[model samples]
Target: MNPAVKSLADRIEALLPQTQCTKCGFNGCRPYAEAMASGEAPCNRCPPGGAEGIVRLAAVLGAEPLPLDPERGSEQPRAVARIDESLCIGCTLCIQACPVDAIAGAAKQMHTVIPDWCTGCDLCVAPCPVDCIDMVPVTGERTGWAAWSQAQADAAHARFLARNARLVREREENDARLAAKAAAKLAAVQAEAPENDAERAAQERKRAIIQAAIERARQKQQAAQPRNTENVSAAVQAQIDAAEARRARAGLTRPGSDQNANTDPEEK
Candidate 1:
């Protein structure tokens, strides 16, 4: 690549979301940038970049009127990536899919999205079998993009430390809450507990008696039920035969079945 073209490509890439969603019908932002610079690819290929990106590119390149390529996708509201911790198998598929390397985690480790780095490409959402990833808009008091970006970077850096200052504060607060809850729970349990040793022994004896009664009742119920092993076995065998016949009709044979029906085992 020529230095001039490379410089132009870098500028174009800077304007892109870097999500690497490939909505542009190219491999990634760099390829799309190169194509656009060479006039082979249009400026409207990016959906995540939206109208803002189009307008910016147009202004830079002094291009004529062009519509956002509908074939690429539509410009939706800005969204941040979120992972449903419950469904996430931590396969690191999303991590690999992220163009910017916005997702962080090892295989089988819980992955988190860096909101600032996430381009809201929706690329990671599809490859997930568990459907755990979701895109959510930034709500509450709105902060400008520059500030948000800085804050996101700071957060990412903080995560590298053994104990982040912000996390330590949060942990302290959570620990206080948990400690209070534990104390309350202990009090409640103590109140409900038998008052004296004799009372505790009596309660244990009653529990034992109730458990024995329940066991006896279960045993009696089992004895009363008629066992029909022959009938059960016959039903199971019928199902197996039906399945085998279906497979045979479909040109699949059971193991050790005659490969050549014309050559009989009796002849051998």
Candidate 2:
């Protein structure tokens, strides 16, 4: 995304309802905004935004206003998902489907929606295996931007972004743990002294296997990590520098560093 298109997409995303609903044929409002800014999608596909939203988008893009696309969906009064607790059967499908994390419950426990946080996206309705969720209209006849507030949209977007960040952090942490384990195993293999040529050959093979595992784990962790290096805070950078310095002084390679470096098995 070039600077100009990204700027346009940012403006477009700000105007979106931030429902994170897939009704627009995109995963979320930001992706839809990017598509629109790139001229790959029209501004009328968002039923939550309705006719008024199309006007706002047109004003931003200097394009003609379009009516909300009927094929995508019809604009209706805002609603919230309500789970029939008696019928819930503790499946938690609705919780998984909700983009805003509005549904609260665990597996084998009844799920309930926090009405205040619900975006009325209807995403959770279809995923319930027990057919216990219902969309209850909350905003009478008001629809689109009229029914939704800028504060609400901002809040929803914040929660969506936070959820994504947490998931990424969790995955990266898991990968790091696996990488640490593999590195430990590699160290253990290297510490095993060979008593004969055959034992030396077997130890070498084991070392090779452990090194490969560590490499794979490191690659996965690297891929899972966010690529926002430019946004690192000064304090965080200082901490990282200190940690690297410590590693250098300790005569121990970083977990992912020098996986294939040769050293005597008993050097430690």
Candidate 3:
């Protein structure tokens, strides 16, 4: 913000309740105040401040007092949240949802609210999954500024700013860690270099060994088959047939052909 606008915004911000409830449609009271000072938004949107807040804003800006915009909300008693520990499932949703970080707990652990830091914004109640959180009235019969003091509002605003800074820092750190891990994983994948010359040579040797073994097996199978009858010489086959004919004519058994049958047992 420029010095001129900042001065005006600070003046406007000083009058707000700093609920940071976003009821005014901005993220927090400072943004709402800045918008009002910039003529972008009206001064009566804060229900937490009620009629008095509007009047104060109007007076500082040198404008006519406007009625509190009922569309935002009606000003009433301030509220503080309470946690039913018995019902809490330790989801930590309420802790994450608390704008001021007034609720404290880890994931899967029960949470409790700090009364001193509570802004009565009721932001943390709805996000509780188990319906364990409740907003109870803290200032009954008192409304707006009467319900909350300026010191408390200022303190809440400070805490809100601090919480915002802390969240941003944590998010940035997590992003950096994730990026580094991704880069490391990518490097690891790239490290598996392509096959070297030695590996290629070893593969070639194994292939040659396998092929030689297969050739030997094929040759062995061919050698086991019976010799073809056509491979015998024609002259030799004719001579053998003639010899068999002569033997038959002589009433003699062919050589080496059923010799036991030709010899009688009485001859022994």
Angstrom error of the Cα, residue 48, model 2: value is: 0.6
Q: Between candidates 1 and 2, name the one with more favorable TM-score.
A: 2
TM-score of each: 0.49, 0.76, 0.69
Candidate 3 ranges beyond 4 A from true positions: 196-268
User: Candidate 3: which pairs clash?
Assistant: none
User: What overall lDDT goes with each candidate model?
Assistant: 0.58, 0.76, 0.69
Which 10 consecutive residues of model 3 have the lowest summed lDDT? 253-262
| Candidate rank order under lDDT | 2, 3, 1
Candidate maximizing TM-score: 2
User: For model 1, what is the error of residue 84's alpha carbon versus the real structure, in angstroms, after optimal superposition?
Assistant: 1.1
Q: Which digits, one per residue and each the tens of the lDDT, describe model 3 over residues 1-268?
A: 6778878987798789978888898978878988988889988899999888888999988889888888888998999999998988777777667766677665566678877778988888888888988888889799998998987886666556545544544544543444454455445544545499886676566556545544544464455432112223454355435434543574431121112222223334
**Per-residue CA lDDT of candidate 1, range 154-251, in tens?**
33222212112222344345434444544554455445578899988876765665455445434643454321111224544454345334434654
Q: Could you list the CA RMSD of all candidates, in the order they appear?
A: 27.5, 10.6, 42.8
Model 1 TM-score on a 0 to 1 scale: 0.49
Worst 10 residues of 2 by lDDT: 253-262
Error of 1 at 192 (Å): 77
Q: Which candidate leads in lDDT? A: 2
TM-score of 2: 0.76
